[model samples]
Target: MLLIDLDRFKPVNDLYGHAAGNAVLCAVADHLEDLLPVNGIAARLGGDEFALLVPFTGGIENLKRLAQQVITSLVAPISWNGGAVKVGATIGIALIAAESDADTVLHAADLAMYQGKREGRGTYRVFEDSMDTELRERAALEAELREAIEHGAIEPFYQPVVSLPQRDCVGLEVLARWRHPTRGLLGPDQFIPIAEETGMIADLSYHLLRQACLDARSWPSHLLLAINIAPQQFQDRDLAQRILAILAETGLSPRRLEVEITETALVQDLEAARTTLTSLQNLGVRIALDDFGTGYSSLYHLRELKFDKLKIDRSYVDTITMSEERAKLVDAIIKLGSSLGLVTTAEGIETDASVAWLSGQGCNFGQGYLFGKPMPKGEVMRMLQAGPRLEQIGISSMPESRIHAVPMEAIIHCGVGRAA
Candidate 1:
């Protein structure tokens, strides 16, 4: 039995669309067929994965040759939807011995395929017992995540969002942190996918929203709070109603809350997403497109949805120092957002150089490790009260600290009092 795993397939499907994705899959199947013996069977197991069963009464050399052929065949570019798409495959080989059952052989092949994925892909690996240990560890982590959420072990961390031009603390982004009683503070990488797969993201989303609102209510009235909304949360029929109720119960103004959704969410079911978003917008809440340029359909969705804000993904920002292409892309996205009358926020700003470049390029806002990592509500409040500072030496200077110099009478007249 042999299994082939395609690497980085999600980005291709995401950037080029599923029709292109299907073309790649079909090409892979054809390649496998050409290599397999007449009795061999090739099947697409779905989503960039494929399986082949060959009557392997043959030597190791023959199996290696077949793997090489399959890889070489897949190297050719595929044309779909007027675009050229390229992809590579990783092959895993497992022999069906005289004593082996079909299931056992398939299992071995599957493990070997994953081994190829782990070993940098575009290569082949034989099955080994070690892969079983890694699988079990992942399973255990997933189970623990379920228990952690049930026991209210997840906590919120706040990241400060500073205003551009003035550089004042304008808002906070609520980030989820899992604090396993036994495992200490676990990052989202440990449990987020588990939450998504198990359909627990909706509950988690509501929990985070409520917690963030409640915390924001305790802060100075001028500060706003933002929370990420998973696509699954939108699938809930009563999501808009639930958010409205939460805002009313918390006595928080809807204007102070921003819910971020990715471009993928907008594309999944455009009409339904539009209705849901319109309802939220009607309630005075702001909607921001998260990871703007990362999605293939970003421009299409931007024209259709008319979101209030466009958040540039970190992938583009992270590469600005290394690649001019990324820098130009960021520049174009900022201009695009501006032309659409949308506020643009660049995420993952990690250095003085990047911040200077983005600020010069007319980017409206930025978020990254350079400003602050996500913290608890109290820490964020303290940071906000401390005001914004310009840490970069000799690049562009920050605007004067007029944010803190606003008179107490003006604040009172604005009807926003200091936090208790």
Candidate 2:
């Protein structure tokens, strides 16, 4: 028995509508039919899921090969409406036994398929007895998460985003942390995917936003509060309104709030994202594209969306000191931001060299452990009250700035910006 689940299928439906989604599904069905062995029964088990029951005389090795082939076939992009719609499949294999009931076999395969998803996309897992226990634990954790959301147990931690060269605290990025009763303190990685999968992300996000907004009430007016919006939250048509309402209730001005979104969110539904972003912008809120270099269509998104800031992903910054090519890329990104009148923030700046290089390259903002890790609300309050000073945090003085203002000469040298 093979249970297959399609990944990234919703994004296609969201971007191109249900017609494109149905077309892609039909294409997948055709591929399954072509790939199935003799006497194998291929069935559509419902939305973006399929099952294959094959009468096999072969060993487990052959089934493994067959699973890989199915994965390869299903992952190919299907052309739709003059564009390509791509989706990936995760397969779970279960061997049929005379004593096993149909329901039991299907449940085992389902658990295995979910395990494959948790590991990563486009992989296969064979049914194992241990998966059942894992599934139960996951269910219990989900229930605990739901209760925690209701009780507002999830807390926000703030990481400071400092000005380049000067290294002054300019803003704080709010991150989520869960205080689990049995598990102690849990990071977002432990429960965020579960929240997203179980459709509880919206509730959890709103809860966190409300708390963060309230926490920011004591912050200085000039200091920004940047909060990341999950990709799934973009699907909510009332997203802008809900956030605006939260701001109003908390008595925090919309101007002080920055909504950071990933490229994955933008690609999901550009029209919807544009509408929500425009609404927020009109209300004096700022929009920033987060994890900038990690996405496929950064330039396209920059052109289409009215982003106020472009955040450089940490991957580029981590290697800039060691890799000359990476340094050039970072320089180019900063130049790109400068030309577009958008502020550029570099993430994961840990060393003095990284700080010096980024500041020299004219990156406007810097974040990462070199400055400060995400701290609880109490530490954030104390830091803000104490004032923005590197000496307070025990960091040494920063090197002088190499590129200060983007003068006409520098613009000409960089091959960007118009002559003033």
Candidate 3:
């Protein structure tokens, strides 16, 4: 038994119409029928989902090959009204046995399909006993995450982003940490995916943003607050408007907030991203292309989007000191940022050597544990109060007056923010 789900199918219905979407689904059904084995039966399970029952005495590799074929068939766009509709599929396979009930088999295949989706969509997975345990744990975690978001248990932590050569803390990146009652502090890796999958990301994100913005109001005017926007959130057409509303509510200056977007978000819908980003830019919000050089279309994004900053991915930063090739890549990226008149921030900077190398390469900013780990609001406030030592972080001291200059109008009660 194979359970298949079409990826990005909603966009077809949304962009073209139900007719075009139906055409795509019918096309998929035809392709599945052509590939079915002898005595194989195929049926639509409704809403872009399909099921196939095949009696196979063959090896598992044969089943894998069939799955791959199904994936490849959809690679070519479906022709519709002189336009092309594109979609992909993720399949979950389960072996039928005499003892397996219909509900049990279907549940196993469904779990496997979701696993495939989570591991980067457009793939296949065979049902496994371990997947059942994982699903249960995920469900439990999802419930906890919802409660966490509702009661403000998931809070933002701040990591300092400092000027490269100067080493003065110019801004802080918002990273989310869940203050679990029994488990203690939980990193974003624990709950962010669940939030994204369950359609809770928007609410979770806005809650964090509201708190982060309120917290930022207490920082110096010169200091900026950088928040990463998730790829899933880009699907929201009114993303810019929602952000504008938050800034208005919190009274955080638009100039002091930087929005970090990944290449994944840009590639999903470049035109839509452009429209949203342009709206934000027009309102004084700075944008940074985060995790640079990791994505396939980095140069294309640079050409298409007017980004204020380029963040060199930590993978390159982690090996620059040890690997000559990585060092050169880092150097090239920094020079690219400089030539494009964009500030470059190197992520995962740990050693003084890495810091020196980055500064020498003309990188504008640095962020990582060597500066300071992500801390809560009170710790951030204290750090701002007591200027960091030059000897400790290999930079000159920040001015005392600049550190203390939080405007009277901007003072407010603090709250948590960000997914790191």
The number of the candidate with the highest TM-score is 2
lDDT score of model 2?
A: 0.79
Error of 2 at 66 (Å): 1.0
Off by over 4 Å in 3: 4-52, 58-91, 99-103, 119-124, 388-420
Number of the candidate with higher lDDT, 1 or 3: 3
Q: Which stretches of candidate 1 lie over 4 Å from their true place?
A: 4-28, 37-39, 44-49, 55-98, 108-126, 384-420
Models ranked on lDDT: 3, 2, 1
lDDT of 3 by residue, 1-420 (tens): 889899988767755778999999989999999988899899999999999898766777888888888899876799999988889999999988899999999999999999999899899999999999998988888898998889988788877666768776666677889888888898887788788778898888898888998887786666666567877888899999999999999998777777888887776677788999999999888888888999745997899889988889899998999999999999999999889988788888889999999899898878787776677787777667775432234222323212323222211111122234
TM for every model, in the order presented, reads 0.78, 0.87, 0.78
Query: What's model 1's lDDT at 61?
Result: 76
> CA lDDT of each candidate?
0.70, 0.79, 0.80
Lowest-scoring 10 consecutive residues by lDDT in candidate 3? Answer: 408-417
The per-residue C-alpha lDDT of model 1 at residue 389 equals 48
Model 3: colliding residue pairs? 156-417, 176-418
Q: Candidate 2: where is the Cα deviation over 4 Å? A: 17-19, 80-83, 391-420
Residues 158-231, candidate 1, lDDT per residue (tens digit)? 65455454444455566678877778877665676568767887776666677777887777676666667776
- Residue 289, model 3: lDDT of 85
- Scored against the true structure, residue 267 in model 2 reaches a CA lDDT of 86
